[model samples]
Target chain A: MKQYQRSSILVIGGAEDKVHGKEILQSFWHCAGGTSAIIGIIPSASREPTIIGERYFNIFRDMGAKDIRVLDVRDRIHGEDKGYQEYVEECTGIFMTGGDQLRLCGLLADTPLMERIRQRVKLGEVTLAGTSAGAAVMGHHMIAGGSSGESPNRALVDMAMGLGIIPEVIVDQHFHNRNRMARLLSAISSHPERLGIGIDEDTCAVFHHHNEFIEVLGRGTVTIVDAQAMSYTNQGDVSAEAPLALHNLRLHILGHGDRYNIKNHQPIAAVVE
Target chain B: MKQYQRSSILVIGGAEDKVHGKEILQSFWHCAGGTSAIIGIIPSASREPTIIGERYFNIFRDMGAKDIRVLDVRDRIHGEDKGYQEYVEECTGIFMTGGDQLRLCGLLADTPLMERIRQRVKLGEVTLAGTSAGAAVMGHHMIAGGSSGESPNRALVDMAMGLGIIPEVIVDQHFHNRNRMARLLSAISSHPERLGIGIDEDTCAVFHHHNEFIEVLGRGTVTIVDAQAMSYTNQGDVSAEAPLALHNLRLHILGHGDRYNIKNHQPIAAVVE
Candidate 1:
């Protein structure tokens, strides 16, 4: 086991407040060393990688980061390129933008660039922030695509492999706003051992102390699904498209300033100042 | 443990040759006591349950059945009706037609009519034959719906509760014709403990001796997927829609006249007579 000196992972739901009170991004900015942060923006998930990459680069730059680099690796070759790999290794903070998670994984999966980022993040040397599709890729088991506004069932969600940045939990973005509770529930039905975290739009679940805890931030609430205590689920017994019944799954809804212990699956109320 | 004296289950893939030969249906008819058979047709899965039920009624009538009743229960109330429950109880064999499995389960699941059928089938007092969606619902864990031609992944299949006529196995119909290999593989990834039996069009996997053995019949073949020896699976690790990798899953393909030991997961070739 590696000893971590300092590590922080900021997971933001999609459609964060970019103009008024950019609290989530600002929190990410401060955690990335603020004025002295050497930031790298990865927008490979977007169809317009350059535009998306530049967008994040400008946001971090405007926050007074000493250096900002848009490392847009569009293909496997680009992902394997030494220049991109070096930037991923050297960046103090890395931000991944949202678009298509399949495309992102297709281009970067198993690449040296992702391996380096994973290594640095694991070593507590870099602060990583991802939003929307970016946030979806943080789990070892990723939800590549799924529909909302449906009952929880196997057909409601699609899952794939992820970057394993946070292997213990599966993350969903634009959660409650998009009626993704069913979708996330469908995902967790297959993986009861991992925690399911749904970050509402503009919300952030900031991980610290080696991902042992999460501090909810921003205006929206974070929904936590803990199935470790789940007694029964018809997931293995049922066919697709059928409504599922899951028993004993614990759910927690937390607002800004609320903290949660990931290891213990417990919630901590923030002390009023 | 309840000792099974004589129990036979015919799981037919869809599009069985009702016109020519009709080897699979003939086997089912013979197992149902041939000329002395008192059969009940449950077409609750079909949109036109009455029509589908009568169609099977006519087929059995043509086969010189002593008696045949089309027990077309379309709703839960109908499933609970004493008339339907009596028909289910008196029938020597039950034949379920293919349509929408979800609809079938919605109407009949947990109903007294279905409970009586389950009880009789488990007691080796009745022979049961279900085709297509009916076949899909034989397992304790059912495959309600799914898409074909996709790589094996969680998204490729949807699963729901089934009749559990055969609790130890998951069955898929129209196997080769519809290219349901990946679909069955996807279903089995979530349920490695249950045997996967994919019956090709016009084929049947006849389970006998308390479902411990299966004898293949009809023009097509039976593909058996046994994941008991599986060493690893990325099913829990990947998100939906992403391709999955399952290692050491043993697959067996058997043609007409071949036999298999379900408990041992071993195939026995046909003897030259």
Candidate 2:
């Protein structure tokens, strides 16, 4: 018999307006199982880990997460420290701060602490959430770096290995504000099998039920680029310095309260309430 | 006990100077066991399948292969045709043409014919080679499309499912001339576990001995991006419109007669002629 497991992920685009209303944070809190949740803030992605870690700590604390703590992992050596594994293992919710994604992956991707966190998430023990760089590292095919523009071109994006929390999708933060549509299109164009999620600033995409459905929240839009049916491209014939031209690419724009079905690649309209 | 099998792939960057000396094609022919080879050409990626297929058919024919056939797979349904499976099964070499990679994948991927090709490759029955768009689909992580540029940025490249002939690598064609360095770097940055090979026009990277070593052949250079030890990137913290900044990314450039060790991520210097 196939084993059933529950895993949840919260991917927030950069600059989520925390002071405005905290709707996104509230969604994350609820996904983490509310007041009884024990949250662990992984600030390894941040250059100033302590400062960034404290910010999330206070936010979660104010949101009624009574048992919230920060895990300050500085390097691969620190991530391997057995002392930190227990904290990650004990948490019902794990929140990763926004910073350099490569820093976070470098410090924790192969460590015991990260392994523990992954194991717990696999076993339905925790809800993992990240914002900006933190959110980018949630997927296996991470958008490590890239510039934003209106036109799709070759060599515009960089990809790196992520934590493998979400294996089938690639997440990009601060979508619309930065005009990342071109780059996102480029990413999906190159790897059509993997879904691309462009989370706008102040918005979040909550993936639940084993990542089958993603519920969008907050003030901004979440753009979905599905290149599975992409038909044409001059990628092979065109010169390197020229702009890219692709046809039959599909795009989906979802806003607050909207839900997306990953299995079917369909969008569900939000309830009017 | 583990199963031991033999498989090989020749990925050529686009615009290979087929007319100049046919050095890259010669390498592929040699790998396919020379005159004794029975080759199959899959022109599914081309909109003009017959034209492209016939082009390779003559090339392989002139190269002294007695048995050369084109597998005109029009769609997913045609790929399921039982008659065509025999051509792919009997061939000692299979060459996929350059056009729309998505077209090739759309028609052949997951179909019975594709499965047969994969089975044959795994069983050491055939040598597979592809150029340009053909080459991109050689790996599991396919570069579907992207524009050319000198710098890496977010969403600058797209990735899709390839034929899975090379499971641990991503192949890009027209490396230097197209200025695809940025996109390839982006790919490796996001998925460091997988190696990235950028084949310049007319160059080919031949994977043999169970993909333990890659032999570079052609006039142009092959760029290998190894991201396993990548240390840092400001991918997450920076604005979406900002260009990428990465540190400690390892790059290797190889020319004719140069070989790369996949396991060690090192380049073997070419022997002085």
Candidate 3:
């Protein structure tokens, strides 16, 4: 395991305004492996990243993190100065502003900006805070919601890959408002090998390194799906025009104050939250 | 495409206490898809399924369902019943009673009972309804969530694989009740080549055959995840002990009463609900 100076992620389902922004920032501050300089990566999609950056920048500023700096990944992805790399080197933490997770990931992907961010996180002492899409992109798979849940056969729905900072989880923004648990579970059940997480609007799941489980914050619930011994093929013998015939999957439920271990992928029975 | 006689599904998301069992049954009945007989599969897992079934069975009975048979997949998975295939063949719709989807699928999977059920669905006219886990297994992948948005570098946490019905859609139940959207999005986004659907409580998404768009029902919203263009890897160079790194992905929003067409494994735009 690569040691991180400060390792923590403040994952919020949505953060358009202040109602949960303060708490979200505090959570990141408390859990960031260690250190203080905060870097915010502003993305241009869905909405302006500057909006959420202001929220975090302000909170971080109050938290004694006066060296907060917002870097536009778009402007820095190819810049020769390695300004992003340099910024990450000196920063105690890095923040990914909320916008379209796809936008943020796209900008940082394969660029020195994301590479340096990864190096900083792996070295420890990088506090990661992302609201809405920012939060969604931290997962191995990111939720890109559209349309409704009429049937599992629609071709219009899909999940985009994200930053992979949190490889074990999949994320969706505005979870409760859009009613996404079903889709998440359905996605997990087919594989029945990956756990699915649903984070509610304005809520956060704080992961502290070496902790057996994560702590849930905010008013709404954080759902869990654990299928340990499941087997089935999603591809049935039916043709393209036929209805889907899926089989063989299971689910275990979890809520706030839950302790889940990644190695075992099973709940650790209750730990002091 | 293998022709189906009719298609319908009973979506039971809410508990009998929170949402009327009768209401769930009525929803199925109204979307009967011309089903005259509905079979309920019940297995012990939690207290809700049985309670719901007992209270709502009469309603379907009142609706003049020719036969409302309740059978245990365990008793019939391997048993040789001369009428087993005929029993399933005679039904216009086979309604799976809600309970532990795993236990139910476990017993019926790969058995003559499941084969019969599969054939019945293939015959089309068979409406399979699953509440909670029942809904969770409809998709090609199912979520067996056990809490791991924190550490994903390790092996998968959930078990997947269920009866093949819905090929691409990943289904999660009680979507809004529990925060599962993020997890589902992660599961599919990690793959970044599939779609995820979260079905809210007391709701259903009806799919019309021939690749037509899916229709929505109930008071809850349905969340969709699309990943037409996502670039990611194994979160390479990251360990199970730290926050993983991710790359690119996108997200789109959807709601209830809206229709989404799945073309090329991505969610296209649809009219708002």
Top-lDDT structure, candidate number: 1
Instruction: Give each prediction's DockQ, rounded to 2 decimals.
Output: 0.02, 0.01, 0.04
Q: Write the per-residue lDDT of candidate 1 for residues A1-273, one digit (tens) a residue.
A: 011123789898888878877888877777777787889888999999988888787788888998999888887888788877777766888889999888888888888888888899988889998999999999999998887533466887999998889998999888755657667878998998999988877878899888999987776667777878665565786577754545445655565676789887777755445
Give the C-alpha miss distance for residue A239 in model 1, angstroms. Answer: 0.9
A-chain TM-score of every model: 0.96, 0.93, 0.80
* Alpha-carbon shift of residue A230 in model 2 (angstroms): 41
Q: After superposition, how far is residue A227 of candidate 3 from its true place, in Å?
A: 3.8
Q: Write the per-residue lDDT of candidate 2 for residues A132-186, one digit (tens) a residue.
A: 9989998888888887532355567787899988889989888755656556756
lDDT of each residue in B4-85, candidate 3, tens digit only? 2256554445442233555445556655532455554444233464565655466567667667655534453343455656
Q: Which segments of model 1 are wrong by more than 4 Å? A: A1-6, B1-273
Local accuracy of candidate 2 as per-residue lDDT tens digits, B49-168: 999899888888898986898889887888877778877767888888899888888888889888988888877778888889898888888889886432355577887899888889
How far is B197's C-alpha from truth in model 1 (Å)?
38
**Cα RMSDs of all predictions?**
12.4, 17.2, 14.6
Clashes of each: 22, 35, 111
Cα lDDT listed for each candidate? 0.79, 0.75, 0.54
